[model samples]
Target: MSTVISHRLSLLEDTNDQLKQQLESLFEIGERNEQRFVWLKELVLELLITENTNQLDRTLYSKLSELENIDDVLLFIFVTKPKVKLKHIRDTSLSEVPSRLVSLSKTICEVCRANEYRSIFNVSIDSSGSFALIPYQFKDIQGVLAIGSSEPARFAGRVDTLFLDFLGEVVARVVSRIS
Candidate 1:
């Protein structure tokens, strides 16, 4: 009977040890994810601040140039006719902008205009990279902020749009002020 009790205690101890290791591993992963989230948020905030500066296009290009993952950041503002107004190409080697990204930005702008929503966030992946289009409305004018990432999995499973939504609002305010 004593032997049986001792064996049961040993099994419980081993189980507790495994659980402790697992909990520690989970905490480490959580901390890493938290740091990533904070970094992303900071990048977005920097973009907003850059937009507020007098030199909008140059400042924006410089701000985005610092980010390695971002391939390109395009700003399309709706006018009498749809057009790609401002494009900041990260890679200087590219002769021209990719047609697919241009098309995607136009489509996103059209959707936002048709819906007349305050903001819309859309994401897609292609052979080039993962793309995110954030369309925002400031009064009558509609604009799309398109971001392209070389990492295919960068935007995967990112269902939470809180950051993007906040970014859209800030962009709309800035656009309104400039216009």
Candidate 2:
């Protein structure tokens, strides 16, 4: 009877160990997802509170640069009425942006207009960088927040749109006040 009880105790210990390992694995995954969501939330709130336009541009670039695999950030405002134009807002890198990026931004803006949804545009430029274009709208004014990285897979299937959508709503409110 003592031997039987000892055997049962050993089995229970093994089961407990397995359960602990499974719980730890789940915790790790949950922590990663939470980090991703938190960064975007902090970024949007920071942008909303920023009062100066120039400072806002700098702040946006700076915040995005802190993210893993993100090397730079660019901002563009789209004007689409009597004439269509994409105005460059800011860029973290001083290097001249590739023409392809401009065209991609235009395409993203059109898609956003057609779908009336915030879209993520992820592209890889040969030997140059990987880019993620996050399209946002403010009333009639449309904009794209571009994130670039030397790491080709940085934004590939990785961007979370929850905070981007929240940022767009906040932008609309701010623009409405100014207009």
Candidate 3:
């Protein structure tokens, strides 16, 4: 009877260990999510305060540069009714951009696919491993935000893009206000 009790106790201990590991994993995930939330909030605050295109451009460059995986960023705004002229921002015709980008309202990130990506920025990123094409629109302001990474898996298909969407939304809000 003691042997059976010992076996049962061992099973219970194993289950307890598994539950503990799960809890630890959950806690770690929560901490990471919290950090990301804080970072997004700070970025939104900074972007909201931008009063001009130059300031907006600088804010985006500075904030994105802080990330190790992000090696480059470019913004292209579609020529609108009033035509925004910003020395720091690139203005392009809607017809010039790839349709995939024009149609997308969300960010599409993946390992380098030369054919589609080559013309988006009007610059060659043959060496980049991955890139994100984030599309945004706010009334008169519509544009694509491009970010590249040297790490192939950094912006892979598995990466969560809710953060990217938020970034795009903030950019749209800033552009709408400043333009």
Clashing pairs in 3: none
**1-179: candidate 2 lDDT, tens digit per residue:** 99999999999999999999999999999998899779877876776676655656666667777888766565655443222122225322212333444444322212122111112223333353455566556566555566666665554455555655565556545433433
The local lDDT score (0 to 100) that residue 35 gets in candidate 3 is 84
Residue clash pairs of candidate 2: none
Q: What tens digits encode model 1's per-residue C-alpha lDDT throughout 15-75?
A: 9999999999999999977976786666556656654324556655565556566655656
User: Model 1 — TM-score against the truth?
Assistant: 0.55
Task: List where candidate 1 sits over 4 angstroms from the true fold.
Answer: 1-54, 64-68, 81-85, 89-128, 157-159
Ranking by TM-score: 3, 2, 1
Of the two candidates 1 and 3, the one with more favorable TM-score, higher being better, is 3
The lDDT per prediction is 0.54, 0.54, 0.79
RMSD of each: 9.0, 8.3, 2.6
Q: How far does residue 9 in candidate 3 sit from its true spot (Å)?
A: 1.4
lDDT of 3 by residue, 93-154 (tens): 77865776678767898988654446554555556478888899999889888887767888
Candidate 1 vs candidate 3: the lDDT winner is: 3
